[model samples]
Target: MIPVKISEEAIKEVRNIMENKNIPDGYGLRVGVRGGGGCSAAGMNYILGFDKPKNTDKTFEVDGIPVYIDKGHVMYVIGMEVRFHNGNDAKGFVFVNPEIEKELN
Candidate 1:
């Protein structure tokens, strides 16, 4: 199982993007943390691309979608739920990581 749970909406949206972009067969969704050194909270970033897993990377296949996550970032991402938003306020994947939320609380 993946370290995090992905919403059906998110999966559909990702697949739609892949089809539209004509991403190659092996390209997978990349998920990880960024911007902690200078920011109050670290934000999640997503990239639709291809890259081999590093020695310190953990790989997971969720609903036919391959996910590569760095070992160091796992703690922050585990148990999170990914959802896609296309409303007026937001228009992308939003991460609901309980770990970070609890920490900030």
Candidate 2:
């Protein structure tokens, strides 16, 4: 099973994007880690985008949305929750990972 989860709000937003953003057919949500330490509270940054799977990827479905995660990145990203935040100040998907926090502690 995928060790991560996507919030209802995030899933809704993804659906909205899929309909209005014209994401290419066969593309799926890609979740992985970025190497830049400064980009997130955790040393590794989070990656979320739409792309096709490659040989090195592990694929799954979350709420009917296809998801792809590079096999190498799975360890660093486990137990994460993907959420959408919309407020007066900002709006976008926000990643919350207690697993990383436990490690950092």
Candidate 3:
């Protein structure tokens, strides 16, 4: 099984969004790889509040929240950690995958 990590803040944010939007069950963040905007390589994409994930998607639970990742992205995403940063300069969820950088460089 692929391992995924999610920060506490991100969990809180997702729960808050779910509560505020009154979204029913089955809504979660989806991450996947797509053709990189006409580039020859693929890139990552993230979608929040998605109902149905693609058939080729794999599901992982992080901090009691469900996150979906496309099968094509699994190899690249394994061992990756999702973190939420909230500072005066920046505030958001960030993906940290060192293997990807090493591969790119």
Candidate 4:
């Protein structure tokens, strides 16, 4: 089973961007954690970008969209859903991770 779920809208948007940008094959959307170092304790955050899977990356396909996630970040991203928001407050991809939300609450 796929580790994460990607919304159809999000997939469409990503595909459109990929076509417009002329991104080549072998490149996929990468979902990984960043920012755990430095003096300030801001904590880890998610990042999304077009990149090639690294040796330690785990790949998943959602609606034909290739997604690469670092092996170490699999736990944090598991069961998460990526959705596209066009609402007034936000107009981009949003990650819905129940586990993290519960922890934050």
Per-residue lDDT over 1-105 for candidate 4, one digit per residue giving the tens place of the 0 to 100 score: 767778889999899888899878999999877877654324667788899879999888876778899897887667888888889887999888767789999
TM-score of 1: 0.74
Query: What TM-score, to 2 decimals, does candidate 3 have?
Result: 0.68
**Can you tell me which runs of candidate 3 are displaced by over 4 Å?**
37-49, 98-105
How far does residue 35 in candidate 1 sit from its true spot (Å)? 3.5
Q: For candidate 3, write residues 18-77 as lDDT tens digits.
A: 788876687667765545565433465533344656788888777666778778767655
Of candidates 4 and 3, the better by TM-score: 4
Worst 10 residues of 2 by lDDT: 36-45
Clashes by residue pair, model 1: none
Give the Å error, residue 105, model 1: 14
Q: Cα miss at 24, model 1 (Å)?
A: 2.1
Give candidate 1 regions above 4 Å deviation.
38-52, 98-105
Estimate, for each residue in 40-100, the C-alpha lDDT of model 2 and write its tens digit.
5467889899999899999999888999999988887788899999999999998887666
Report lDDT (CA) for all predictions. Answer: 0.75, 0.88, 0.68, 0.82
The alpha-carbon deviation from the true structure for residue 98 of candidate 3, after best TM-score superposition, in angstroms, is 5.5
User: Which clashing pairs does model 3 show?
Assistant: none
Q: List candidate 4 segments past 4 Å from native.
A: 37-42, 99-105
Provide the RMSD of all predictions against the true structure, rounded to 1 decimal.
Answer: 3.8, 3.8, 3.9, 3.5
Model 3 lDDT, residue 58, Cα: 87
Q: Give per-model TM-scores.
A: 0.74, 0.86, 0.68, 0.79
**Candidate of highest TM-score:** 2
